[model samples]
Target: MNDAHLHMLVNHFPIVGTILGLIILIGGVYFRSISIKNTAYFLFIIAAVFTVFSMSTGEGAEEIVEDMPTIGHEIIHNHEELAEKFAIVLYLLGVVSVIGLITNIRNHPKATFFSYAIVAIAAVAVFLSTKVGTSGGEIRHTEIRSEAVNQNSNAASPKSENNEY
Candidate 1:
């Protein structure tokens, strides 16, 4: 599949999986259940995998959408920047979650501590992802799209060849 298609398919996983993981993590903590906590840890791992997929397809996505009429270039720019930030956060959380899972399987003493720590990291990820999602949504949403048009109209310069990659 094309990058844009892959982007559309996988982009939702990080946020949605994080939310689902958070719910399970919270439940595990509240109920003090090992099974539930382990499940949440696995979910975070799955989310990490999706994050990789999203990132891998990003350049393809950018190439496809950066040339669309209106704010396509601007939206692609913002989305690229935000995606970079989001990837860093997701990678960190994913690593922490992996460690937490490994320790849990080994019956390590610090497993619970790492789980909570990963949860905290995941919370920050959730916030950043919301911003990313909002910026991405603006790419095509009428209100933001109109704003983009007006802002660019003021400049009224000849459209330069988009060199974004």
Candidate 2:
């Protein structure tokens, strides 16, 4: 598959996985369960890893789509900028998770509290990261197309799509 296709698939892993991890993490905190918290931590770590994959492939993806009728330099720049931020947050999450895992294995009582703190920040990070991904999608897949890509492929067509294709 092309970089765009692969990037799209990898991008969602971070969004969904991060969201799920947030839920599980919050639930674990509420229930005072170590196993559940650790599980969520692992998920967050995995999400971060995929975020890297997405970010690394992003430049190539942009190269493929930059000249498309619906795409523009601004959109690519915006996506690149946002991806940098997302990468930072995801990397932080991964590092935090590593600490979390270590803490859990060593039975550090305070680790749970630390996890809560990290996840709280991670929740915000995840939100921003998703926004970046959506914006990037919008670069080539405008709202009109996005609205119908799944239901009516015709609507997703670029208004000036003929020029590029």
Candidate 3:
């Protein structure tokens, strides 16, 4: 398969994983369970790894799609920018999760701190993921574009007697 296909395959894990990891981590923290926290950490690490794969394949995907008839360079560029920020947050979350795992395994005093930190970072990642996903969706899904919304609104308006929309 081409890079675009590969990118589509791998790109979703980071967003979904981070969201799941965040929920799981919150549960772990609420219940005060080290084991659950570790599980969340593992998921975060996996998400981070997928982020790497997604970022690596992104350039190739862009090269392939940039010339397509309906795709906009600006849309891709916006998605790329948001994706970069999202990647950074995920990477930080991953590294912090590793440390959290180690500390929790050893019963370190700072394990709680790391848990909270991961929660905060994962929250940011989740927010960015929404923007990145929407922007990426706009690249191909013309029905959801801003201009499309405007056109739809205009079309839905009540017609005047003069037959002018």
Candidate 4:
């Protein structure tokens, strides 16, 4: 398959994974379960790895669709910008997670501190993921765009009899 297809396939995991990791991490922290915390850390690392794949394929995907009738440069540009920001956050989360995992494994006194750090980073990652995901969806899904939806609704409404064409 082409880069565009590959991108579609892999792009979702980072967003979904970060969200899942955040939830699981919260549970781990609440229960004080090292194993669950490790699982969440692993998921964050995997999500970060997938971000590389997604970003690498994104340019190719843009090239293939940017000129399409409804998909323009502006929408793709927005998505690209948000994706970059989200990727940075994900990378940071991944690094912190790895350190957290290592500290936990060694029974370091600061392990709990690392868990709190991960939670904060993951929260930021989750926020960015929502923005990136929405921007990416808007690139291809014009119906979901606010302006497009408003235009559609206006067109559907009947004009007054006094109004002339």
> Where does the lowest 10-residue lDDT sum fall in candidate 2?
143-152
Tell me the tens digit of each residue's lDDT in model 2 across 1-165: 999888988988887888888899888888988899889889988988998899878888988988988677887897789878877887898888889878988899879767887777688877876778687767866863355566566655546745763
lDDT of 4: 0.95
* Residue pairs in clash, model 2: 145-156
Give per-residue CA lDDT, model 3, range 47-165, as digits (tens).
99999999999999999999998896988999999999999999999999999999999999999999998999989999998898888888889999989999999999976879755
Better of 2 and 3 by lDDT: 3
Residue 108, candidate 1: how far off, in angstroms?
1.5
Query: Which candidate leads the pack in lDDT?
Result: 4
Tell me the whole-model lDDT of each prediction, alpha carbons only: 0.84, 0.82, 0.94, 0.95
Better of 2 and 4 by lDDT: 4
Per-residue error at 149 for model 2, in Å? 17
Candidate 1 lDDT over residue span 1-165, tens digit each: 788899989989987888888889989888978888889888888888898999899789888877877556767788889988988988888888889888888989998898789889888888888888888777767466546779778678766688677
TM-score of each: 0.83, 0.82, 0.94, 0.92
Which has the greatest TM-score?
Answer: 3
Candidate closer to the true structure by TM-score (higher is better), 2 or 4:
4
Give one digit per residue, the lDDT tens place, for model 4 in 15-84. 9999999999999999999999999999999999999999999999998988999888888998999999
Q: Which stretches of candidate 2 lie over 4 Å from their true place?
A: 144-165
Candidate 4 collision pairs: none
Clashing pairs in 3: none
